[model samples]
Target: MEKDTYKTLAAPGEETLFKEKNSKFFGYAYPVNSEDEVKAVLEELRKQHNQARHWCYAWQLGTEHIQYRANDDGEPNNSAGMPIYGQIQSFDVTNVLVVVVRYFGGVKLGVGGLISAYRTSAQMALEASEIIEKTIDVHFTLQFGYQNMNKVMRVIKEKNLDIVSQKMEMDCEIVVATRKNNAPTVLEALQNLYEIEVKTS
Candidate 1:
């Protein structure tokens, strides 16, 4: 069965350096949710490692890990990017990006060597970083009158749902995030309140 939650890098950046056959490979891992963030991080890496020979990378997005990419940056096909991505899959984590920057050391490592180096470098980065588990959340918008605030709050407290945001004016509105697995139960309970309006976001 597919999991309701997943593991990903907890923080933004982690680095690992591997030297093989006199070639230097610097690996960097980052937590990201969108492609724009991926571009931003790659651009930043370019700025930081301006003199590197290749900027190979791989990224997986979303809990399902369906959206992903691998770029070899000029290295032989499957020698660099795919190996780096293999490490990501091996870790069984998503919503993360790993970039490996290669600095030519006057020693030419063949395809096999390149793959080993990239994979090891990527693994080193993940091993050094913190991994975090993230639950899949379903968002909801709740609208109700102030008179029902107590009732709604009581249910929220009982469920321990995360109140993403709330407004407490004449027309009270609250946005909440519930674990995807618990959404049905929570929605059923909320429906019992006739006056309160609930909509999934």
Candidate 2:
């Protein structure tokens, strides 16, 4: 079995915000998820920071299969969104959104400076909060006789596997929920211990 892939989230129903200041630009970046959600967030941030010059953004959605978008907004072409998007990609994150709000500080920052500001702001925001990769949820069912139930249960316990559901009839049937990557190992271990039926769902 191959390792399951997932993206990282900053926190549960929480967002990370960061601010950076250069001689020419003041920037704020937010790391988020979902296009509609990030758009709403950008609107709110724009409203809150009405004086800002530009609100640029980027987002990556879906699982290992992903969809992505970036917007320069009013900044130089590819300055804001591209850099922010690069940072998120560098971290191999998916299902994430980033918006960089720029407040012009009266001086003109060249394209390089603009890119640096957006990238730094996003990286900082991600670093400030705990980012955890998502896990793929998979379930497996194991069936064995009463004679093997105790030993199998012990092994399951030792593995700290999540018991999603259980059924007991003439024999004992157990259902385990865990990441897809771990399911094969779990099933192999159980099979080694005794005659058991394993099904992945």
Candidate 3:
């Protein structure tokens, strides 16, 4: 069976730039998992761009991408944050963040201009980034006596399970990571071994 996977920014911390009407927009992209990670990235940007006029951002999390937020940061409503989020959706990426810092240049860009500027700046940053495919994973601990170890090992080998850790002796324990979507099949096969012990951690 195929495992579940999704597209996301390769890693955190890519900087790109876009300018309009002498206003410099510095866009930063980050691969984030939790809200805490997003906050850390935002805080880092705030410290780095303390003089900037606006710090707008958008983030999407989880495979379902049910959690997300767009912050305009003093920019006109629907101008800054939404546009950045639009680009994230456009890229079809989740578990990612884009923040654009605007250095005002005395010229006031109206709503339309602000939207376009933010959108384009964020898009540029995303374009400069390397997107990657990631799989949802589950971890489990498998234990058995030496007598039944071969049965468990054979099943693990057949499934190509990732060994997170292993302790092999008279009694053996193996910690494995595998795609979350494949867990049911793998777990069922492992459990079929009558004398083996399987536990998820």
Candidate 4:
């Protein structure tokens, strides 16, 4: 299966503030590929919004099959993070993160107002940035003996294939990572020179 790719920007290295009414929303958005990156961004947002009333966030990650999470961060359940997450989904994007900071406007925007504000903030930030889609890479493992190691390695290097991992057993096991669209070509090239086992990861 060919994987899809998308591009997103990272959060500002420094904090940025957006205001509506008396409330100040400090926020930052970043591109994330895995749970660890999402968690790191959430932690950074928490730290940046330490003095604010709430730190809410949402993220979408993966290629064909993606996962997402949202947190209201102490605000009325579903009022903060959900709205921001909705915006992310609406954009049909993956591997993206959005954090919204609320300072409390003194005048509550009510549920509707909160939702609108957060959604708009997230949408605007995404719109202001650039996004690109590319092909996602897939990994395959090839096992062969020392006799064919040099030939296999040469093909990988010449084709600019990613060598994700390697191990030596009775036969050498090499894990190669390449774009899904290129898998067939890569496999054919390898099989021509040596016996190879291809597996997806």
Q: What lDDT score goes with residue 107 in model 1?
A: 91
lDDT of the candidates, in the order given = 0.91, 0.72, 0.90, 0.77
Best candidate according to TM-score: 1
Clashes of 1: 0
In lDDT terms, how accurate is model 1? Answer: 0.91
Give the residue spans of candidate 1 off by over 4 A.
Answer: none
What's model 4's TM-score? Answer: 0.79
lDDT of 1 by residue, 73-124 (tens): 9999999889989999999989999999999999989998899999999999
Task: List ranges where model 2 is wrong by over 4 Å.
Answer: 12-33, 138-178, 182-201
lDDT tens readout by residue for model 4, 46-125? 68567788878888887767788898888888988998899778876778888888898799888888887888777776
Greater TM-score among 2 and 3 belongs to 3
TM-score of each: 0.95, 0.63, 0.87, 0.79
Which one wins on lDDT? 1
Which ranking of candidates, highest TM-score first?
Answer: 1, 3, 4, 2
Instruction: Write the residue-wise lDDT of candidate 3 on 1-201 in tens digits.
Output: 564888898776568889899999999888988999999988888999999989999999988536999999999899999999999999988999999999999999999999999999999989988999988888889888989877887988999999999999888999988898889999998889988889987
Candidate 4: worst-modelled 10 consecutive residues by lDDT: 7-16
